[model samples]
Target: MSTSVADYLLDRLRAWRVDQVFGYPGDGINGIIGAFGRADNDPKFIQSRHEEMSAFEAVGYAKFSGNLGVCLATSGPGAIHLLNGLYDAKLDHVPILAIVGQTDRSAMGGSYQQEVDLHSLFKDVASDYVHTVTVPEQLPNVLDRAIRTALSRKAPTALIIPNDVQELKYSPPGHEFKMVPSSLDLTWPQVIPDDTAVRRAAEVLNAGEKVAILVGQGARSASVEVQQVAERLGAGVAKALLGKDVLSDEIPYVTGSIGLLGTRPTYEMMRDCDTLLTVGSSFPYSQFLPALDQARAVQIDNDASLIGMRYPYEVNVVGDAAPTLQALLPLLDERADKSWQADIESKVARWWETMDSEAHVDADPINPMRLFSEASPRLPDDAIVIADSGSAADWYARLLRFRGHMRGSLSGTLASMGPGVPYAIGAKFAASDRPVIVFEGDGAMQMNGLAELITIARYWQEWTDPRLVIAVLHNNDLNQVTWELRAMGGSPTFIESQALPNVDYAGFARSLGLEALTVIVPDELGLAWDKALSADRPTVLDVHCDPNVPPIPPHATFEQASNAAQALLRGDAEAWGVVKQGVKTKVREIWPGSSS
Candidate 1:
């Protein structure tokens, strides 16, 4: 009995516990597609509407499950389509493996039909590792190495299998590839450093009276340790967007996100802090960081390359966040001064009050913020929320509150749109028992695959548990980009380019056999949410929202203010209205006698 190279590859995947492979079929790689049919129930093959969606779904799987996500594509254009999604995973530091089929080995360099130079094409995207299997003997070794590299580096890896090689009979190597089990450990051990580094970090942290702690996605598992350190030092906690779910709003001194889509309290904490401790996040926006002259910093990260790279730090603690915090706990002195923490809490309280008021602002078209404020509290205890890029992401970052075992993530780093729906589709399968909800913009839905509603419907045919919901912010424009233009001192004359034609998203979903609802008023929101949650199948809620609402940055510059004035002079009333609202909100936030 002999096994095909495809069989050996699939076997290695099963051994690595890859239960799902997302992709589409094409002419260049029919052999592996045949193997998929023979794979039976061991590893399910999910067919996506497009190759790009397949890769994005793989990224979603890796992000949500903390495991290596796998996707397959045929040669040439098919393999090229995976780049955008692969870059999404690469930039976000999630582990994902891309298996691409190639034209026959005999077709090299002669411009054969559908042939591509995959090796050079994937080099930059899969900088961590990329290899092509030239022979049957190389099949198992190449597949194993690709997976290991993706896991160890927390990045994307590519394996190119030529069409001819996939159908060849597999032969046992005369000598087996060396296996170093310890080197390939996937347990994610919390690597701690020697006492000297911890002591140095503790010294810097203990010296400052006004300490602030900023957490990122990498510190998600260290929630308890993070809270303990913040409590002992009486420090204020602020989160990066990726770490929004790291600490809930229940923590008194915890300010929300920090940056353009951030809260005022977080901006104030970052600006006023004398000492800063950053955990596991390499947040790229340097403007939001505290000034070097004002603050001394201690940075904790497992990747030494990232330590002190974003800011000037007095101590670089190269270790896992949880154990490093645990080791540094004893070296800190308890600060008796409670003034800094108290001030931050007061600001945070007021910030929340302003947020509540803004969420309910009266407008002809429903305000988008109201959906998050009113619907978030009603979500299932174990809901997995995914937000698309654009205004939906801006609102979700600031307005949605995560509590009690709930988890959430967006297309961080790349900030790419169109992944919201596919991510939710992937998450629903990854956490089958938990409910999955998506907040998507109308532009993003049209850009990605609105037809993917068919994919969800296809999968739902096999499952009895109803567990997917999509909430579409049905504003007929790319509102986020429009705001960015206005903030950057540009005229809104070209706003017409970002506008989208009115499409009935709920009707489209209903056509696919999924339950659907459309609402135009704030009062209909709750019942629509209720119906979506209780339905026995996938559901979509299309809520019309005012596109004039601006995603105001935490701080605005003089030039930006001038830009808004210029637009208003040019008869751009929408820009004038949004900027007016922004100014009004800022006044309320800073005025001494104003309520939250």
Candidate 2:
């Protein structure tokens, strides 16, 4: 049988070394689905419960694997469903290629069923590249460029294939004038800034007494270099949320995550630092950084376009983080006085103690912070952790301590919910030998996580190490937004919108033939974690936690406190519980050993 456009597409993806494509089925993509069957599932099609989950799984795979992630969908509704996750990829700067099917070419202009203008819909999210394949000759070049652009730009790209065109006979571009042919091989170049910029950055660091370094996901490969530079300059390191796994928290000088979900030491260090060295991080909260006039700053990033925008820098070096820091290391003079670093270390120690005290503080049943705290010490060295955007992220950011080869991430820039469970699925696929863990809130779990649990039950046995623990903070509230409404909007928690219907998350997991554990008290958390970790298949831990525990910012402003007070006066349903928990949690910070 002669090859079809759909067959050739899969062949090309396989040539690019793509092993899986996450997607859902639809009539618009029937041709491709048929081709997937004919190809004997080469470059396997991993079916997700929804198109949105497919895109999110692709994002997770790309983020953890350091490769191009691909997702597929049918026309109109399926394509539209992919937007949120694609935007997540775009915002987080992950490389993803979304292959969407469109209506038959003849029915397109006549507005037949599912005949939506996919190009306009995808234009912004896949701004780097979004094209419609009208003919078979356009196949290889368009697909190759989409793959290359997504990889090079670290952004999402798209290809809209008409259903009729997908069924057409495959044809290669001719050797004539208008035809373009493409290659499968691509090698990324190591980019480094010129010598002059490196020298200037070094000079600024060498002249400073108190130095602070900030890192993001882009500095993942530069861990050793970041540490070396920090040692030479007597700098304290602060990690952006996306860079949480870049450095081990065990390092005395390494402050935890920055911004709203950050450590107190990080906030204090940024407030007092005389000089700043930002490496591969685009942390958006400038208020959390040093005062504009107080610190001389230098930024190093691979993308010149993103540099020099977040802050005014004395020097902007366009280079890969590891090599750039390596080059700057030699030029930097070692600091003779270690008093500044000593102070930072002391602050870091105090911050951890405070976090511990807060985690152990009394709650109605299970303290949410204690879940992450217990997991931190018990996490496998090769674990891959993922957190959804909610109160779960608050505790994950503050309580978890990443060490050894443990890697953790979430929808950092997007801060979207529902990716926690799907990301763990993707992570498990990305590294089958590693254990994966995910923190989810009750809201997020109900939104889409419950369905993705079926996806896990379907594939968990295939994995070499069958440990995927889903820890659900079953607080029956949209805890993050509830707190935001009170603290930011000065409005009371509107129970109608904030309250969630309680569901048996563990029971649902057991129905799917996976291990299920329910924790209602603090003492059950550690043992539940152990059982889940040792389970033969995927496991779910549904812990009934207090919804009133406030996720206090590192440095709370007077205005925010006033807003919370106003919200309480306005008759928040959980006002008394909020006041009680907030006081107890805050008291831990003031006196770490005090049991209030």
Candidate 3:
């Protein structure tokens, strides 16, 4: 059997069981894109509005589906656009394969138009595996290596095929490309630590009176095992942002999140713990973690190099989260005392009260926190939510309570904006039967490449249940950066730089042939959510939010207070209002029995 290199590549992808490919067309990659069209039903080629969104949608697909994600792009700028999302997948440890186009082999070293060294450009991002196929014969081995390396290493891999080479005749020596078995699905092997390491970890955990567990995306598949360990040790669980859905917020022992966007329960749990058990989280914030001198620690991770990279640990169990915990569970003595856990639960209760007060505040304009809390219940139990960076993240991280089968994520390490809408679109493709929801700030909604909502509209009818919802928090301001300036003792000057022109997102969605709604009142948000979810196709809900409300830190430092005071002195009305409101709320909480 004989085939062109481009068709052979698609055949190998089919052999690897890759069902979807996201990308944009360009002159350099016209041959490959044409091959995609001719490859029968091997893979669904999703046309994104921009190459950046194509890459981001691929990242989202890998994140939600737990499978290999593939995206394509033409030479030069088209290939360059994939770096951001590829880096996101690399940093987050997701498997993705980028099939990039290249200038013709004949133009090598001549610097033809649109000729850029993609190999050199992708060197750092796709460090694990980066290669190009200069000839037809090299395609088979390189394709196998790229896809296998991406799946096994859980990172992004790149294959740059020249334009002329993509159309070259290809016939392998022994095996025919089309006859290769597509039934064998490759999966990463489950690694378990040795008995000695497991015993040492259990011993360290057993010695401490107060144990706290910090989990990340690495521990996602081990929820049951993590909960069992937490329960047996009477430990409090604090999840990293990437691991938000690992344990539901309603779980009495599970603190919502860790870091600045973390809950008070998580902060207190880490601050007072005698022992810390880290499971698959390389949380970057050292300040948010337990001090090295304060707590003895045990760390479990599949990557041995990342075990003690974040913090010092007495025992390092280098293995998969679930398997390691499964081996260590029987070696531990169940904790008999419950005082520490009870104290943490009490603090969580009070934190909920504070959050509720913030979420249901009666203001003329809707509070963003209130929007998240009120609208959360209306979301489907199994909904996959993606929150964009900025103030919207502050609200989503602090408010949305994951229960039942619900899950959510954001750009954890990249922390980039503009991926929310693309992420939701990618997740919809991964979980076509479930409702896919996104919470993005107006600033992000207007950012470059978010027009891929039109891509969703294009393929809306292909889905089993395309219940995709885009909920935009319309404050017309870069609320997070403004709050940061105030918190850092700087005057909120040059307000023009932070302000956004009002966008009628509902109208925008409607114009794109999707159901849409706009609401200014807080009470009306629930109905908007209901309408969005009930609609058969995609929907967008734009809620007018109060710009005056601040996303106060979970545990404010003295310097933060001083900065707020300085901002107030600088005639910042929002800052002054925040301080006054915060003080009054604290007073009421501290003195509930007082007559005054």
Question: Best-fitting candidate, measured by lDDT?
Answer: 2
Model 2, residue 257: C-alpha shift (Å)? 0.7
The candidate maximizing TM-score is: 2
Ordered list by TM-score, greatest first: 2, 1, 3
Q: TM-scores of the models, in the given order?
A: 0.96, 0.99, 0.95
RMSD after Cα superposition, model 3:
2.9
What digit string (tens of lDDT, one per residue) describes model 1 on residues 1-596? Answer: 56788877787788889999989888777888878777774578888999999999998888888888999999999999999899999998989999999988888788998888998999999988899988777776677789988998899999999988998997745544653222223565667877899999898998898999999998998999998999889899988888888888778899988888888889999998999999989988878889978898999999987788878888998898888999988888887988899999998888777776777665547878888878877888788899999999888888887777888898888999899988877777677778889999999989884878889989975554676889999988888887776767566646568778999999999999899999998988888898899988989999999877666765767888778667666766476567656655566445624543
Compared with the true structure, all predictions reach lDDT values of: 0.84, 0.94, 0.85
Q: Give a tens-digit lDDT track for model 3, residues 1-596.
A: 45788898888888888999998999888778878878874698988889989999999999999889999999999999999999999988889999998888899789899999887999999999999988676777778888888988889999999899888897664455634322234555789699999999988999999999999999988999999998899889999999999988888888888999988889989999999999989999989988879999999999976778778888888999999999999988888897888888888877777777666655447778877887777878899988999988888888888888898988889988789988887898898898988898989899942487788889988888979988888988887888888887566534778888988888988898999899897888888888888998999888898776767777878898688678777877465556655664455345433221
Candidate 2, superposed: residue stretches over 4 Å from native: none
lDDT of 2 by residue, 506-534 (tens): 99999999999999979988999999999
Model 1 TM-score relative to the real fold: 0.96
Candidate 1, superposed: residue stretches over 4 Å from native: 176-188, 461-465, 573-596
